[model samples]
Target: MEYASNASDGTQIAYTVVGSGPPLLMVHGSFLTHTIWRTFGYVKALRGSRQLILIDSRGHGRSDKPHTPDAYAMTNIVGDLTAVLDAVGVSAVDYLGYSFGARAGLALTAATPDRVRSLAVGGGSHGAQAGAFDRLFFPGCADVLEQSGMEGFLEAWSSHRMFPIDSGTRAVFSANDAQAMAAYIRASDADSGLPDEVLQHFTQPSLFYVGSEDRIRLGDTRTAAALVPDSELHIIRGFDHATTMAASEEVLAHLERFWDN
Candidate 1:
C-alpha cells in the first residue's frame, strides 16, 4: 500500500495505493498531504472502480523534506510523480491534481509527452490573479509561521478570505510542519519557468474545473480551458476555492465523465 519514489534531487517521495483497477494518480495541493483526498471522500468514491495512487509530496507528509525552494520547483515536483509511477510500473496514468498539485500535473503532462493519459484539474489556475494577494498570501504565510508558529499561522490563515478551514479539516491540518510549509510557500512564489508552449501544445483529454464563486482563479481557469487542445471547463455552483472539497461528489462526477471518454 505504501511506496517510496526517489526524486531527482535524492529526496524520497512517499505515496500510497488504494484499491485496484485502472491506475489513477491523485496529487494533493500545497499545505496538504495525500490525506486531503481521503478526507474529502475522493478516494472512497473513485477507488471503488480505480486504483488511487495518493502521493505525499516532498515537504508535506511521509516524503522527505527539502530545505530549499529549488527542490520544490514545478519540474522536480513533476519528477516526483513520475518516479512514483515508475516505481509502481505504470507507464501512464489518468490524473487528478488539486490546486498546487494541478499546476504540477499540467507542467508534467506538458513537459513529458504521453506521461498522462487524461487529467482532471481542480482549484489550480496558476495564480495569474493571485499575484495581487502575493503580499498577503505568500510572504504573509511564512511570516505568520515565523512570528506565531503553526497555531498562529493557522489562526490567521483560517481567517484569510481565501482559506476557510472547517472543524474537520482543521483537525487534519494539525499535522502540518509550519516551517517547512513556509519555505515552500516562499519558494513557490518564484516563476515556475514552465513555458506557455506546454499548455499551447497540450493534446489530451482534460477538464478544468473551478468554483463559480472563486474570484481569483475563475478567469485563469477559463483561459486555460479555452487554450488546451481538448478540454472542458466546468463551474461548480456556489463553490469557492476553499470550499471546493465540500463539493466532492459533483467534482468526482466531472472526473468520471472525463475518464469514461
Candidate 2:
C-alpha cells in the first residue's frame, strides 16, 4: 500500500514500503515514478532481505504535482525524502538513487550524513548540474514534452540517447504526467547543485555505477568516485544509459556487497 508524507511546503509525497529487514530507500530518476524499481524487479529482489521504501518525487507518480519551480528546488526534494522516512518512522537507511534521484541523494547525504547509512548512486553523477555535456538535454526534453506530449518526447529521447529504453522502463515512463514531467525538466537545473567541492564532505561509504558505454555519465561517475571519500566505481560493459537500468541484476550485485559490508 502507498502512504503519504507531507513536505514542509504541504506537498504530499507518496511512497510505498515493502519487505522487511534493514530499511532501504530507493529514488527514481526524472520522467519516471517510484514504480520503476518495482516493475524492474529490484523491489522483489530485495524485498525478502530489506524494507524497501520507494518514493515518487514531486511532480512525478502519485506524489503531489506542483507546477511552481520553487517547489522542486534541491532543498525541497531532499526534505520531501526525509519527510517520507520520518512518516514511516525509519531513522536512517541504505539509500539508492538513479540519475536525477542520485543528484538529490548527494545533496541529502551532504545535508544529513547521519540519516544515510550508505549510498548507491547508479547511472548518476556527483555533480550533474555542472557536468560536461555536449548538448543541452533537459531544455530540449522540456520543449519536446510540451510541444509533442509524452509519446513524442519519448521518441525524441530514445532517438537521441545512447541506449534503447527497455519495455518495463517504457511502461513506467508512459504513465507519467506530461505537464508535470515537462515542469520537472525545466526545474531540473534550477537548484544550487551538489558540486564536486561537496564530495570531500561525504564521509559515508558510497558506490557509484555507470554503463561503460554511457559516455554521458562515465566520466562524471569516475570523477565522483574519486572525489567522494571512501567511494568506489563500477562499470558494466555493453550497457548504455537506459540499459544501465535493464542491467539492474548485475548492478545490484555490486550494491548488495556495498551495503552488506
For each candidate in the order shown, give its overall lDDT on alpha carbons. 0.78, 0.80
lDDT of 2 by residue, 146-255 (tens): 78888887787678757776786578778887777766665665554676778877878999998999877788788888898878889999997756877878988998
Clashing pairs in 2: none
Alpha-carbon lDDT of model 1 = 0.78
- State the number of backbone clashes in model 2: 0
lDDT of 1 by residue, 176-247 (tens): 777777667766767444555567788778899989998756777887787788788999999977678779
Model 2 worst lDDT run, 10 consecutive residues: 130-139
Cα RMSD of all models vs. native, in order, equals 2.5, 2.7
Residue 43 of model 1 has an lDDT of 84
Name the lDDT of candidate 2.
0.80
